[model samples]
Target: MIDALTVALGVTALLLAAWCGFAAYRDQPTKDWHFIGMAVVALLAVVQLVIGVVRLAGGDDPQQGVAIFVAYLIGSALAVPIAAFMSLTERTRWGSATVSAAAVVLAVLEVRLYDIWGGVGG
Candidate 1:
């Protein structure tokens, strides 16, 4: 896996979490700008998923095993969009909280992805 891309995804997810968390704390729903941020994170995840698949096809194997790695890739790509959809249905501070939680989950997944691929270099 690409270390830089992994780090980028993780950092971006954390930023999104902080943004949405602040909004939730302010008792606000997810705004259009928040959705824009979600879109950015989702796009990055999709790109990462594609790159992971390509690497796998090229005979690069993840340390933890292929099935789990691909599962994580798919989950990472889906997490934000799923949370966003859930938030859209509620239209309250809880919605923002939901997104914030998803972002944190995505960040954790990113770290796990790095470990699964046997990331070594800093």
Candidate 2:
């Protein structure tokens, strides 16, 4: 289950980053792909919540697990919806900028997840 989640999150991050990069290049409006990417990321994040809680309950305690896990889940859940709404409010390059923001946050969360799994010295 952990491996599946890691793979899912990693793949979603890569795909979303690629889409954001492409959007940056063209200065075009968001397509369905962005929504799809965000949806997938959000789903994976929910799955991660279950996994994290189970691990913590099982005595497989991670260093700083609670804070890190909560932050990661919040970050993952916020990125896409916030970006989409913010982008809609502005009908310009700022929309693409929102994508960039979402991509960076998602990437950061991915790293955080990795660090949490690895414990200290990550």
The CA lDDT of each predicted structure is: 0.95, 0.69
TM-score of each model, paired residue for residue = 0.96, 0.76
How many steric overlaps are in each model, in order?
Answer: 0, 0
The alpha-carbon lDDT assigned to residue 82 of candidate 2 equals 78
Task: List where candidate 1 sits over 4 angstroms from the true fold.
Answer: none
Model 1 earns a TM-score of 0.96
Model 1 has how many clashing residue pairs?
A: 0
Q: Lowest lDDT 10-mer window, candidate 1?
A: 113-122
Model 1: how far residue 88 lies from native, Å: 0.7
TM-score of 2: 0.76
